[model samples]
Target chain A: MTHPFGPATRLALVVLAAASLAACASTKPAGPVAPRGPAEPEAPYRPPSQPGPVTQEQAPGVTPGSVQDFVINAGELVYFDLDSYTLRADAKPVLDAQANWLRRWSAVRVRIEGNCDERGTREYNFALGARRSNAVKEYLVSRGIPASRIDTISYGKERPLDPGSNEEAWARNRNARTAITEGAR
Target chain B: MFRTKNLFSVLLAALATLLAAAPIAARADIVVNVDQGVTQPLPIAIPAFGGSSVGGQVSQVVTADLQRSGLFRPLDPNTFVQKRIDVNLQPQFDQWKQISAQALVTGQVTNDGDGRLRVDFRLWDVYAGEQLLGLQFTTTPENWRRLAHKIADAVYEKLTGEKGYFDTRVVFVAESGTKAKRIRRLAIMDQDGANPSYLTDGSYMVFTPRFSSNSQEITFMALRPTGASIYLLNIETGRQEALGHYPGMVFAPRFSPDGRKVAFSVEKAGNSDIYVMDLGSHATSRVTTDPAIDTSPSFSPDGSQMVFNSDRSGSPQIYVMNADGSGAHRISGGGGRYTAPVWSPDGKLIAFTKQEGGQFHIGVMNADGSGERILTSSYLDEGPTWAPNSRVIMFFRDSAGGGPRLWTVDVTGRVTAQAPYPLSASDPAWSPLLN
Candidate 1:
């Protein structure tokens, strides 16, 4: 594509942005996340990350930027069916994609949070949530991620991505989400 | 139940004749048939205790306590046939009988001018022309409601053969905010929903505050950013200590009947197992080593056994085991899914939550696992707690499209009422009757 702005114009805009960077957060505010619904498994999903004949060299500490990029672009969540922890066909690909991304940037430590819909008993849902998180961890380990790199917590039905009580919303709520906890120095 | 009462009848009959011939020692027995399926609530009359504002408040509290039990109906004050201007005057039995009140309650209140309250009340059988119970309590003004509960308990025990549960308290997780960023705080209140107070700030997410059977303490699961773990809190002293030092997540905790041990589930490598921690020694022992999820461990009343929910059979089912964790047996046969199995205090029944066809129910089965009867059904009804008497179950009912709120159902399966809470609440733990 041809240059949209002239050099002089770009320089002027850059100077203005640098001047306002410190106060940008005060000028702009973030809004609530939009509603999400029952999600179908992603297509062209990669299987769990696996090691080759020769072990791959481990990556270093995760960079915050790359971790954020993985969460935003590579997908950090996998959904589950009602009261179930066994991953679905669609879920495999999404998890496969997650495993591939984690393998490529192996230094990052993550905490897997398993959550459930607001239906089962809180205590029991907690166990179910753990199973979901552990299921994801097992898949990632099968793909070559070090088991030590991943920790897990079950939020049970206590936390939900979608507050709606409908099945569509519950589907969104029943998910395992990964948060980048430690990045390389 | 009636046979136990019959044991006292023979002695009472002899005493009744002696008392009748000797003009009595200042009391009379008031008999009211109180048993399961006693459909008609006994009609009772209560007049103001000498026209004081405190008396009016006490009477109102007492009336609500009785009515909430689904056993006694307090006559409307506006329809009272007699004036209550004199606290010392005797109640005219015929006047109460005229209003068809089977029982009469009259009381007096004294402020004592030192911020202490003195409450006296008497239960009279109007039709029988006899007084059943008389009791007096002196307490601080701030504990006026407790006095009312004590009076109600006295009246309830005299009429019903069972000990009263009115003088009780409940601990629960009071919730607020939305589904995404929900806030939960530990809360406590009188069993009748009065004197509600917050025990914890909403900073940490807390679930399942279960009362220790032997004291003013509770064991609950607290979720923090670091990890999910179990905590033992002295509700009275505000002392909190971590109950487990496990590196993995620990949740779904309950106190042993003696309160010396706490049974909880610990999740490691995605597998949840049951563990018992002896509070005195702080030593933990694994109860279940299975790979399946085993949680919601409730101690049997006698501490000899425990009932918990497990999915070893590929589905969550109620299982019973010795307190030391041997001899696992499935007790929930008539099920779709069963979870949260709590042993009733009387040891005769085990209460649990069952889910089938997308609906949840609070149900009970005999101790041996036969005769499963579903109690209340709704979009979600889980975590059934037994009243100290085991005659009632309190649980949280989530409306199909709304948040959770506290609800209660008696064993009769007929009386279900919302236990009022200012905010959304769940996982209620009813305390044992206060001494």
Candidate 2:
């Protein structure tokens, strides 16, 4: 291969160059053609910058994103006394913790969905569950979390924590749960 | 001679008095409360739809149509009287009377040799010894079964004094998955839970599906990749469109009886309230005004009044108001939390989920919220929807182990049975008669 290209390289290159120029001249407009440009070097790829966790004070809306996350991580189910929609005294520690979390993560969005056991009328139990969940939300709001970050819904007896029929199941069912969605910062 | 004269006199006097009382009783109709009754279903006798050689599958359909009502007990064919063919023309009062049946349905089907089927049926007040109603239907050969259902409907409407729900469909949430994240699909089945097919996959959580009276469209809540939105999915075309998707959550979607509007909850800035949107105009009217949480709105069959779940009572209770949001009254009394108030088809009762202590149950009461009765017990039983007949209620029952299953019960609290399902199912919505 080296012998074949070396000897005839100059003569073949001249003939090939003439043929290529003729082909280009045939395809192009008659008068003039711009000189062929030199190729430019390619640039290397760079990674994108990572986003930082939303800060409590920096997040939009009234409630902080960190506080809402803390409340969510701690747990969403808040309990009440038997047959009562009022938030029980025992539930305050959890509510206080949630308040602190909301304080830290003010931009986070949450839904306080009220739920109930398989004991009452489905329609009325919905209202009761709403009452319970709203009660929890009001407590959090009073403790300095903006009401806007805490949306309330009543699953009533639709969704339950425990699907059992026993007293423990009932106790677990008579409560509210929280869910987080993209609306949170 | 004296003793013979006395016997003849007694016999003649008894016959005369019985004949005289017959006309008065026949004029005075018996009032049967079709909606309210004992667990004992009404016993009706249909003697195989006797005819001369062309009954052709009509009797079986007629019998099934009445029996599936869960209100009528059709007598066994084997117990039918000899020569029931003659009974169709004119039921021998004594023969039906002997079986202790209250109502007798007899029909004759004949092919006129002109590519037409003629069905004539007579409903007899067996006790009264007279025909209550009779009609004749002529249709194509393929429409014999429909004709039979029509005849049965007439008989049912006459005897029960209420419209029949035999030609209806059921839409329910076919559920599968764990306790934390339940996957639910929308499924449609015949009123008897037959011919079940999925309308949508359980890709996301779906809730509170309701059928338009035409049975062609369904309104429900679904959480899509974008967010939770209320969607009206056309049952026939498999097309879906989002309805009123605001920045916040919108749920608890229910259609008005007329199917002209839908009432749902729209949450903005954490406050939830009931809003009704006219399907034609896309204009929304707020139906509730409290700072408290309100959702789950249901319209009465007449579309004049609405019942919804509200926490305005400090505890959750059911409240009823005029469709315009006037005359608001708390229908649910003290003792439990209530939710999901579905108006009965006949506009007599409201079925709802009740929670007391720690347990939840499906309960019902008069539309005024009196005579509240609980119909189910479980770790979680909710969402009681009336069967089209309004005689039975279907609801969801869940155990701690797995997904919620569907069950149905009579108003009397007896005859509770699990609704047949290939998968765990819940959130049943009954459809009105199709066509």
Instruction: For all candidates in order, state the fraction of native interface contacts they contain.
Output: 0.71, 0.18
**Tens-place lDDT digits, model 1, residues B21-118:** 11222544444444463588888888877534688889888889888788788898777777583544557777787788888888888876776677
For model 2 the local lDDT of residue B82 reads 51
Q: Model 1 chain B, poorest ten-residue lDDT window?
A: B12-21
Q: Could you list the iRMS of every candidate?
A: 5.4, 10.1
> lDDT tens digits, residues A48-94, model 2?
77888876753222233533444434556678765577788778888
Backbone clashes in each candidate structure, one number apiece?
5, 45
Model 2, B270: alpha-carbon shift in Å? Answer: 3.1
lDDT tens digits by residue: candidate 2, B175-233: 77665456778888765555577777676778779998777789998754334578998
**Which structure among the candidates has the greatest TM-score?**
1
Query: Candidate 2's error at A36, in angstroms?
Result: 85
- Number of the top lDDT candidate: 1
- Whole-model lDDT values for every prediction: 0.80, 0.71
